[model samples]
Target: MSASVDIRSVSKSFGDVHALDGVSLAIAPGETLALLGHNGAGKTTLFRILLGFIEPNSGEALIDGLKAGCRQARRLISYLPENVAFPKTLTGREVVAFYAQLKGAAASEANAALEQVGLGEAASRRCGTYSKGMRQRLGLAQAIVGNPRILLLDEPTSGLDPLSRNDFYQLIAGLAEQGTSVLLSSHGLSELEARASRVAILRQGHLVADGPLAMLQRDARLPIRIRVKTKPADAETLHREFGGRRINGASVEVTCEPDEKMAILAALHQRPGAIADIEVIPPSLDEVYRHYSRANPDKEARS
Candidate 1:
């Protein structure tokens, strides 16, 4: 089946600055892809190109095989910007209803969407009266009203509290499960680490890395970290044998190559009495992201 969203060798430039450089990606139905990048990392530029707000200097972006920015493609996509704003005079219900009309969805969907985002009680209140978290939820309600084939979210959880953030993610997960292709961009690397099916990192206008978390971790060749908690008396012995540094009176921290993880675990298992607990941690998304951001692409290509 064709990808729901596809960008082929797309590049964009603004005079001296190159916003994107030959970035290509594809998202399948029901897939949730995370887009990671720092400020000016071409994330917004790429979103604009896909939204048809601007054309790329080279290559093409397509929404379900249709050229991006075309009417049919636009109808297939929905976007929630980082900062959501609405006229202060309009009520929450009015705001979403307007979007529903624009998306050709029934006005009743506005109320259902608002309730889905936990804004039901305040739906009649003017947006000007809503708190930041409430406003964010309102934005989400509008974005989801029509159930577009592609959903694009930017800094989606910015103003949400912990509980509300959880709800937000659950809602996104449900949408993806129902066949919506979601492309999410956020600075919350830790959150995306577990939720995203695939991750695409952009650095200095280059597609620095793209893959599942495990694949990126493997390709980056980062070590697996192990922290062992032992009896105070056993800590020193474990440290001596394992060659890891002591973190505390009862803890020793060690790192090994990815391929050595199983052997190390087996060795640790043999010392049941000395080891009180063991925690094995793989390279995190943040670590992998930093590794690629600083990696010299030119050197990597030559190697």
Candidate 2:
């Protein structure tokens, strides 16, 4: 039941501040979209508007063609807020079971969901006793019940440890394999770099960039790092020919534009056996985020 999310010409304002200005984006089924922005950049406001918590000043948010928050849309959409809450008295199993019932699913389904999130051994533990990561996994279990068509997550992995965070993303990848669309807002740029199929960045409520990671990197025109390893005896010769900064006795690092990448590689072939090894690192997500943020600093200054 994977479904698409469409935000069309959406805008919102609070007094003298504009939270969103004609923001538009479409998330396809099975796609993972990472929403990037700083505090007060309208990321949360956009999520709120998409979930229909507040009305947009203009345009609309739709779930697979149905109006957001409508009976059909509600059935297909699920959400996990940045901060999760639960009844202190309820056991993990009970909490999942209770919420499943609310969503018209059975207790057995709850057990399966708990098991899916690696919480099977802790299903009987009381909510108050669960660790922060455990609570997050429980919240994820809640969001995915009934195989929701789309999942909206805000800072979903905020407090998770490295291992737990890896587990969380793996679970999400499996869900996407089953065609579940995901829209997650986060500050974890490096983490999201490889996971998100596309990224839509928000600055002061306006979308400043939207596309696949590679495309955005090219658009940013950021430098790509190229490193080559050679013998210490030939390091000077290679440096003279390749024109890059030498690292140790055997490596040199060169920063070049994307268009120059192929030409640089072609020249490397000329050295042949003289070069022992080489590596090229593209612009990181951090650099990509910084590029856009700097370009749109005007809005942040206004607020």
Candidate 3:
């Protein structure tokens, strides 16, 4: 069965410091949800609570209708922390085997896990000798070994190379296709924009925005940036026609509703060789986060 995460009115505090405040969200099975927020925005704290590494001061974190730390929930979930420390003395293979045993994976699964992460030949080398990327790969291997239904990843591609990062995303996509849910918390907004089916934005421990990528963009009141290339003389006319303002001799910029994007394109297309190219740029998650922070300076400042 597919897994789901239900976070209900979760709140956590450290003395006078509030980490999460009345936050609630749900992540459906097989969907890749990106958690976007700045440092100390309580993304890590929420992640920890969901993984049962910490208890929320109030509210519940449940997986597949079970409490966060319940046996069944633990069995169905795997977590890859941002900073993973393995015993320096143990070889990579040994480390994998150790975790495999913890997950009750077959002994023979260790080698395959190592190979899947492109660490087959280096499996015998001590973790101390492994590079950061290699260590990250090992952590990913551990997360995947158990075939858990829900994967919680924090900065999963931290040290991976470009190719490895692409491969890692592909792997995550494959897992989602196979009914495995993934919750990813990352600062890599561009990458998350391309990978996530939905994005949940947190500001000062509160979920300021939650929905599909397109929906969030619309709900955030973010302007749609349109750039058009046109002849110097036609630029002004085109801008006036499209209700945009001319930025330069041949470039025009406009902030339009997301729904009007196609109409804007159609307007540009009607320009009869007047328009050379058109681009629609949505607000990046980083930009959206900044907007929220600016609007709630006191809350974000505390974070």
lDDT of each residue in 26-122, candidate 1, tens digit only: 9999999888888899999999999999999999999999999999998999999988689999999999999999999988889999999999999
1 against 3, candidate with superior TM-score: 1
Would you list the C-alpha lDDT of every candidate in the order shown?
0.88, 0.85, 0.83
lDDT of 3 at 202: 78
Per-residue lDDT over 39-100 for candidate 3, one digit per residue giving the tens place of the 0 to 100 score: 88898998888878899999999999998987788998988999989999999889888888
User: What lDDT is reached at residue 245 by model 1?
Assistant: 89
Better of 1 and 2 by lDDT: 1
Ranking by lDDT: 1, 2, 3
Of 2 and 3, the candidate ahead on TM-score is 2
Lowest summed-lDDT stretch of 10 residues in model 3? Answer: 294-303
lDDT tens per residue, model 2, 95-183: 88887887777877888999998999999989899998899989999888778889999888888888888888888899988889999
TM-scores, all models, native as reference = 0.90, 0.83, 0.81
